[model samples]
Target: MGNTMLYVITSLSVGGAQKALLNLASSDFSRDYPPVVIALVEVDGVQKQFAEAGIPVHVLGINRLTQLPWVLPRLFGLVRKIKPQVIHGWMHHGNLFATLTWWLAGCRPVLLWGMHHTPEKATLERKQHALVLKVGRWLSRFPQQIVYVSRRSMQRHAELGYAMQHAQVIANGIPLGNNREQAAHYASVRQELGIPANARLIGSLTRYVPEKDIPNLLNAIRLYQEGGEDAHFLLAGEGMNAHNPALQPLLSALPDAIKVHLLGVRTDAQRLIAALDIATLSSQREAFPLFLAEAMAAGVPCVATDVGDIAEFVADTGTIVPVADAAALANALSGLLNQAPKVRESLGEQARQRVAARYSLNAVIQAYQQMLGKVATYSVSNA
Candidate 1:
């Protein structure tokens, strides 16, 4: 554990930040750093993935803000015991907690912060995040470096008074090889979803949150269906099912001919992507969504809103539309769906190439390794 790097995140949930951390932890880069993960709250989801990868994960059992006082001492004790060379924080609450723990433990490790979101639109889920940004402006000197998953997120945080001098941008990366096995399951996945073999499958992998704008996607699907397109939709993520009262009305309003399968929190997302003719994202806010990258890696063309870095990621490989514009989304989907098989395949190839060249997991892992090496040297010199 000489070069141990402790990763502190708000939780070990199956979101973008947690997924990125898992990628980093499971990669060859972790061999040099020997990464350990610490969740501020109790480890719920995706923690097993890290453990299975031979990474040690610890939970502080701090479920809410009220538990901070009791949990801080536990964090301090862990810091003193582990004596990690670096303390890397993910997201707002985790960053603040890491900074506090570093100060309290009197540790000499280099501190780094990671930001995975864009604060373009304020929502109740992000109210605490807004407060953290305000407080981070004053405590910006704590972290040796702050890594933003997208350039847009870096710019937004800089504008919001975060430390610009120490900021860096590192986009999320996906393992291209991870989808290779999924090709074998494509037909089976479609059959499992009750979709016809020839039906145009438009899929979205996202949590059913207000920011995701899943209703807008449903509206677009309705419009496309009204035009007599034979399509099926596969939406797989948390809160995507009809069990939610708010989404039941929207789900009920969809046209009868369009087959919609709501598979909540699926483990076979890559296989679902493999079975799709097109992937879609209707998010109002994001900072380089992982699903879009994953879809492209799976050689699936995407139709997404012009939010965050989605347009930049898709480039000419796919289509982009304005947020909340169901008509534009429908038109884009219709155009892609109407394309010849050869044409669509060509576009999908371009998407896969783009991801391979820019967002490969190996490249991202090397980037983090380089950063960690520098931070380690800096900390040793200062010590």
Candidate 2:
């Protein structure tokens, strides 16, 4: 059997889809598959992680739509040379590009499409994505399967005429480890961020995008602080730094009592999450947020909006509030902070157990192996 798989992705940026592909490529499952990565754009944050895992990465240096034609030949050339038995595409652009490239290369390798985001109506980016999905629907028959990270996303896409022959919902999983290891770093992380040792820490790890509703989170923090809660808010991710002009208004609106630590794009996200007393997600839309799972894996209880699989992820372990409701978010956060230390600790333990039992990396890899094995058999039988 040919033990080769090629994964095509938009970029190696530090986002959910990129992280998911990185996890899949670096897992023990790769021992059988011997994965290769190809990014449509120049590799950035996660390229080193892949390289260290002995995976070769190819970048096509595509930054805009005009470069598609110039890069197609390059993609076709690589596909022919590698002749992988399975070509997996991550996200919409990667899926479309992989299908077209495979067709152009005249190959019959099993093609798999991975979808990571939920459909939302308002954003212009989503509108563009809808157009892409329309085209992908026409090409759906070319891929052996379309994998969605959330059941809601799959159903919503199906309703939008994405009638693929084979579709599966595989929730994103986190690699679990000893929570104590991270817990030990809590005091130091707090000290480095200049957060008082006695202050309650509520942290959020997400990019500063409209969908993330960061201002709504800020408003909630304001409400919480107005009520005289002794808490510090930590916001970390892309575009979350002090120099980001967009954050100025929101930061100014926050009460003086609330100390806001804006750590932009920290590579030490896991340590920051470990130091958090409660993790949060204020996104108005999500498919299956990897951060929520990561927080749960770290045994930190989460408080998230009831958006995309969040309620399911938190289920009895953490609090879930309605979307864009600052007051409701504030109330939830305050209630959790007011809980006795032992009660919060118990909830965190429950969160950890839930992630270990349901969303462990081992389980996710096994499911992918089964699916790939079946797809491989089918491809061979057809040939």
> TM-score, each model?
0.95, 0.96
RMSD of 1: 1.8
By summed lDDT, which 10 consecutive residues of candidate 2 come out lowest?
120-129
Which stretches in model 1 have alpha-carbon errors above 4 Å? 123-126, 178-180, 377-383
Instruction: Give the per-residue lDDT of model 1 (tens digit) for 266-336.
Output: 66567778888899999999998998898898889999999888899899999999999999999999999
Give the range of the ten consecutive residues with the poorest summed lDDT in model 1.
Answer: 121-130
**Which regions in candidate 2 have their CA more than 4 angstroms from the true location?**
123-127
Clashing pairs in 1: none
CA shift of 382, model 2, Å: 3.5
Q: State residue 26's C-alpha deviation in candidate 1, in Å.
A: 0.3
Give model 2's TM-score versus the native structure: 0.96
Q: Count the backbone clashes (under 3 Å) in each candidate.
A: 0, 0
Error of 1 at 360 (Å): 0.7
